[model samples]
Target chain A: MEINGKKYKAVVIGGSAGSFSVVSKILSKMSPDFPLPVIVCMHRLKHVRSGLVEGLNLKSKIKVVEPCDKDKIEGNKVYLAPSNYHLFIEFDNTFSLSTESVHNHSRPAIDYTFSSAAYTYRDKVLGIILTGANKDGANGLKDIHDKNGTTIVQDPASCDIDTMTKAALNLFEPDYILTPEKIAEYLNQLAS
Target chain B: MARFISKTVPTLSSFERGLGLGLKDVRELSAFMSDVLGIPYDHMPVSFFKRRLTNVFAKNNIRNVEHFKELLTSGDIKENIYHDFSVSITEMFRDPGFWRYLRSLLQNLSPGKTFTVWFPDASSGEEVFSFLILIAELNMLDRIKVICQHPSSRITEDIRKGILRNKNAEVNANNYIRIEGNGNFKDYYSLQDNIFVLNTYLLQNVETVTGHFLNTAINEPAGLIMFRNKMIYYDKEVSEKGIKTLTGKLSPGGLIAIGGKEKMPESTMSSFKCINEKERVFKKHGFDISWNNGN
Candidate 1:
C-alpha cells in the first residue's frame, strides 16, 4: 500500500472455521522483518468475550491486541475485532466499533471488515477469504474485487471445510487460488 | 432466582402473524398498544394488546388462553383504569451511586449563579423529591428553580401536595437518610392522617409542573437538566433529538445529567465536557451549532 506517496504493504485475511490454524501458519512463515500490518477476522458470537488477541499472541511474532474504538491501524501489528462489536474501517485509517446492531448475527463479521476495507483502501487492499461454513466472505470478496482490489481464496480441496472457500471461489474469481501454505508464501512475497 | 420463569410472555405467533403489518408499523403499534393496555411487558416482543391479555389472565386466574381472549373481546372496559397501568415500579434513587455522584455535582456549583433544573419525564415525584432533597441539603434550592415533567397526573398531584406517604417511602426514606442524614428529612415534612404531607415549604420553594416533554416548550434558561433512564426505549435518532432539545434549553456553562448507560453522540460532545465520565454528568462550556438552530 502506498500511503502519503510512500510505499507500505498490508494484508487482510478473513476466515471462520479453520481460521485459527490458518492465521498461525501464515504468521509463522513471515520473517521477523515483515514490514506491514496483517489484520484478521473470524465470525464471533456476539456476547462471548473475545480471547482472539491473547490466543493469537501466543503463536504469532507480531504483537496482537483487540482493536480499540477508533484506534489507528499501524503496520506490523495485528488488530482483532473485539467480540460483540462490528469493526468498521474509517476513512482515516482507524477502527470504529459499532453497536448499531449486528449483520448476519455475527459481530467482527467478515462482511463488515472486508466491505469497509474495500471502500477505504480500494486497489491497495488485498482481501483473502478462507475456509468457513458460511457464505459471508463471498459477497465481501466480490466487493474487494469490484473496488479493484486483489481477492484471494483457499483452494477448495486444500481447505479443511470447503463451504466458505468454495462460496468465495465460485462466486468471485479470486486473483490467487492456493492452499494456506502457498497463500502464506504469496503474502511473504508481497511483503518483500 | 425464585424460578424466574416469566409467565407473562405473549404468544410468539402474534408477532409472526403481525409481521404482515410491515416491520416499522408492527413495532410502533405494539408499543402504543402495550401502553394503552396495562400489561406487564416481561415478554421479549411485548405488544400492548398482549400485555393487557396477560394481565387479564393473571387477574381472573384464568389459565386458559381461550377464556382470556373472550374477556378481551367482551368490549366491557372502563376509562381511568389505565391511569394505574402507567405506575412505573421504579425504586427511589434506583441507582444510589448515580444520585451520590449527582449530589457531588450539585455541591460543586458556584454560589452566585442561579440554576434552572428540569427533569423531563420525571415519572412520579420520586426523582423530583430526590432532587429537591439534594438541593435543600446543598443549600442551593434558593438559587435553583426546578421544572419537572411526568405522564402521570398522580405524580403532579403528589408534587403539588409536597408529601409522599406511599408504601415505597418507608423503604426509600431509609435509603434517602443514609445519604442525606437522618435528621435532615424531618425538616421537610410531617406525618398527617397517616400520610406524610410534603411540608408546604418545599412545594412553595420549588416549581414543579405537569407536561409531556415532547409537547412542553423548553424556554427555561436551564443550568442543569437531568434526564435519567427515560430515553432507553427511543431510537438512537430520537434520543439524539431529545438530547439536542435539552442541550438547547441549557444555559451556557450548564450541566446535563443523563442515564449512566446513555451517551452523547460523538459529534454532539464537542461543546460539553464530561464532569464524571462514569456517572454521565456532562457540563456545557459553550454553544454548539448542532443544538442551536432547532433541527
Candidate 2:
C-alpha cells in the first residue's frame, strides 16, 4: 500500500484557469485500473456544468463525473467538483456538495475539499496544486502539509496560469514541484 | 539529492487559516444542539457540522464551545441561536434551465385545476420568489397556491415583502435573461430607493407556514415539491426522512424537484421515475411524462 514510501487513502487535485487541458492530459496518462480515487476541484462557470465532465471522460481511461451528494469515493474514477457547489469529503468518505459562501472567490473552493480530505484522511491524503489564477487552494494544501499528508505543486514555470500553484508554494513547502507529465507519472507510480 | 534540493526553495512559508474544529468538539456541539433545539445536527455530515460550528462561533464572537453552550442554555436568544447555525444559500433562477422546465410544466396544467406548490424549506427567499414570478407570468396566480416554510421569520418576512434587493438582483436578472425570459424582467419588480421589490401581485398566493412542516401533513397535497439543495446539509437518515416527507406531501401524480447535485435515497429514487435527470426532477409513479409533452 506504500505509495512514494507511504500509503495514502485519497488523492485530491485542485486547479483553476488553464487547468482543464493539463488535467485531461494527466487523466489520459492514468491506467484504467488506477487504484486510488482521484477527486478534482476545478473552478468552472456555475451554470455550465456539462462540458467539463464530458471532455474529461473522453480523455480519461477511467470515468470522469460530477458526483452527487453522498456518492462513495471509488478508485479508478475521477470526481469533478460540481458547479457552484463546494465539494467536501465528509468524515465517512462520502462526497457532499454545499452552496456555502465563496472562499477566495471560488464556490467549488479547493480549500474546502483539500481541508476536508486532509481532516478525513489525515496523513494518508495526497494533495496536488495545479495551474490556476487564484489563491483558493493554497490554504487547503497547507492543511494537508500540516497533517503530514503528501503535497505537490505543479511547477510554476510550466503552468499556463501560475497564480494558484505559486500561491500554494508560498504558503507551505510541498513534497515536490512537478510538470503535468511528471504529475501523471507520479500518479501512475502511486497506482503501481 | 533531487528530493533534498526541493526543500531549499521555500518562499513565503506563512500558513494562514486552518480547519479548526476537531471531532470531539463537533460531536459535543451536535449533541448540545440536538438536546437544546431538537434538530438533528448529528445527522449532518461531520465536516459540514464542523464548519457550521466554526461559523456559529465566529458569527457570535464566542470565545469557544463553552461560551456558545452558555449562551444557548441561558435561553435569552434561543430562537436566534438556532437560526444562526442553519445554512441556506440560493439564488434566483438557480439552475436557470430548471425554471425553464418548470414554466413548461405549468403550461400544461388543465384549466380550472388548482395546483399547490410546496417549499418544505424555503430557508432563502430567492427560490420562492423565482417560482412566484413564474406562476405570475403564466397568469395562473389565481389557481396556484404556494406553501412556503422557513425556520427564520426574517427570511419569511423578506419573501412576504417581495424584497429582491441585496439578494443579487443583477445576477438574478442575468439568469432570467439566460433563460430567454419574456418581456422585461424589470416589469415584475419596482425600484424604490434603488431597491428592487417584486410586484405585490406575485405575493398574494404565497402562504407562509412555521414549525417543522416536514413532519406535518398538509391538508392539500402539493403538485410540485421543491426540496432543493437543502438536504445536502443533512446525512442519511434525516435526508431520507425528508424525502419521505416530500413524497407524502405530493399529490399522487405530482413531481419532486431536488437540487441538481443531490441524490435521492436508493429506495425512493427507484420508486420515483426521473423526469428530467439533468435538473433532478422526479415524478411519483402515477405521473405521466406524456402529459407535459405539448405534442
Candidate 3:
C-alpha cells in the first residue's frame, strides 16, 4: 500500500459522463479485503436519488453505499457521494456534506472530494480521475500530485468521454493512464 | 425540552482549510461567536464553519483573525456575520420526489380540521412557498396552518417579502412539473428588479417566527416538521441534541422530513420509524391521532 515511501490511506475516484461501467468493472475486480476505503464522487441527476449504489453493489465484491453526513471513513467499503450535496472528507476521517453553490455545475463535484482528500490525507491519498465530460477533477488531481499522492486517470482513448482525462493530462502528468482492467489490477496490487 | 444551544458541542480547532485563519484565531473568534450564534454554531463542523467564516472574512475585508474579531466587537460586521454565517443556500423543491410524496401524504389528511406544518429552519423562502403552493393547490390553504421560523430577522424579512435569487427558476419549474403541478410555475411569482418575488398571496395565514424560538415555545404539536438540509452541518452529538428536541415537539405519529442525503442522528432513531428511505422522512413513534377539523 506504500507509494513513494508513504502508505496510502484511501482511494478517491472521481468520474462523470460515462464512467459507470468502468467503475463497475474496477469494483468487480477489486478484492473484498481491499485495504483502504474507496471514495467515489460522480455527477448525477440531483433529483434522482437512487440507483447508482444499487447497480454498483450488484457486481462489486465490496459493499457500496451512499454515506450519510458525518459517516466515518472506513476501510473495505465504497462510499459514494450522495446526490445534490458536495462531499468533503474531513481531517477527522468523517464525511462532511454541504449544500454550497455548485462548482463545475455539479453537486458531488469530484474536485471537492479530490481536493479535500489531498488536504486531509496529503501524500497518503490515491486519486483517480475517470471518464467525464468536464474538467471537474483536473485541478484536484493536480493538487493530489502536488501533495505527493498517487494520481491515475483512465486512458482518454478508452474513456466514453475523453474530455475529462485529457483535461487532467493538460494540467499535469499523472502517475498512470490505464484501462479499466489495468486500473483494477493496479488497485488490487495497491491493496496488498 | 432539551435544545441544541443547551448541550455541550465539540468546538473545532486547527481550521487548516483554504481560509488562512490560525487555530488560536478560530478559538478566539468562536468564543465571541457563540454568544451571538449560540452553541449550534460552535457545534458546526470545522469545514462548514470555515466556509461560512471565509465568506464573512472576505465580505467584510477582515485583514486578519484579530481584525475580524475587532470588527465583530465594534458591531461593524454584525449584519454580515448574521447574513453569511447562516446557510441561506437552498433550492425551491430541491428534492422533487420528497415534495411529491409529501403532497400525496397531505392529500390523505382530513382537510376537515386544520393541520400544522412547521418549518423549524426555513432559511429560504423557496421551500416555504413550495409547501404553500401544495396546500393551495389541494384547496387546503384555509385548513392547513404554516409556521416558518428563522433566527435572523433579516432573513425572516427577506423570506417574508418573497425575495429569492432568480438562479433556480428553470430547475424549480421542472420540479414543479414533477410534482404534477397543474398551473404554470410562473403564476406563483413575480419578477422584481431581477429578483424572483413569490406572490405574497400564497402566505395567507402563514405565521413567521422572526426570532429564535429557543426550542422552549410550546404550541399545538406539529403534524409535520420540515427540517431538511439544516442538520448536515452539525456533528453527531449536536444533531442528536437537535433531533431529540424536535422529537419532543412532534405530534403523536407526526412526520419529520430531512434531506434525502442526511441521516437521522443515532440517539434519536429509536423514537421514530423511517417511512420513506429515499426521501429521508420519519414518523414519530406514537399512537396515530386524526386532526380535529372543527371551525
Model 3: per-residue Cα lDDT over B114-195, one tens digit each: 6678887777788888888888888888887888887767777877787886478888888898888878889988888888
Clashing pairs in 1: B33-B48, B34-B48, B162-B198, B163-B198
lDDT string, candidate 1, B51-91, tens digits: 33344444556556444344444633312223332334233
TM-score, first chain, each model: 0.90, 0.98, 0.97
Which tens-of-lDDT digit does each residue in A40-114 have in candidate 2? 999999889789999999989989888999999987789999999999997777999888777787889998899
lDDT by residue for model 2 over B218-279, one digit each (tens)? 67788888888988989878898889878877777788899999988886775587878888
Docking class of 3: acceptable
* Best model number under DockQ: 2
lDDT of 3 at A101: 80
lDDT-based ranking: 2, 3, 1
CA RMSD of all predictions? 14.9, 2.9, 8.2
Off by over 4 Å in 3: B1-17, B22-28, B213-220, B287-295
Which whole-number lDDT from 0 to 100 does residue B148 have in model 3? Answer: 82
Q: What is the TM-score of chain B alone in each candidate?
A: 0.68, 0.87, 0.86
Better of 1 and 2 by DockQ: 2
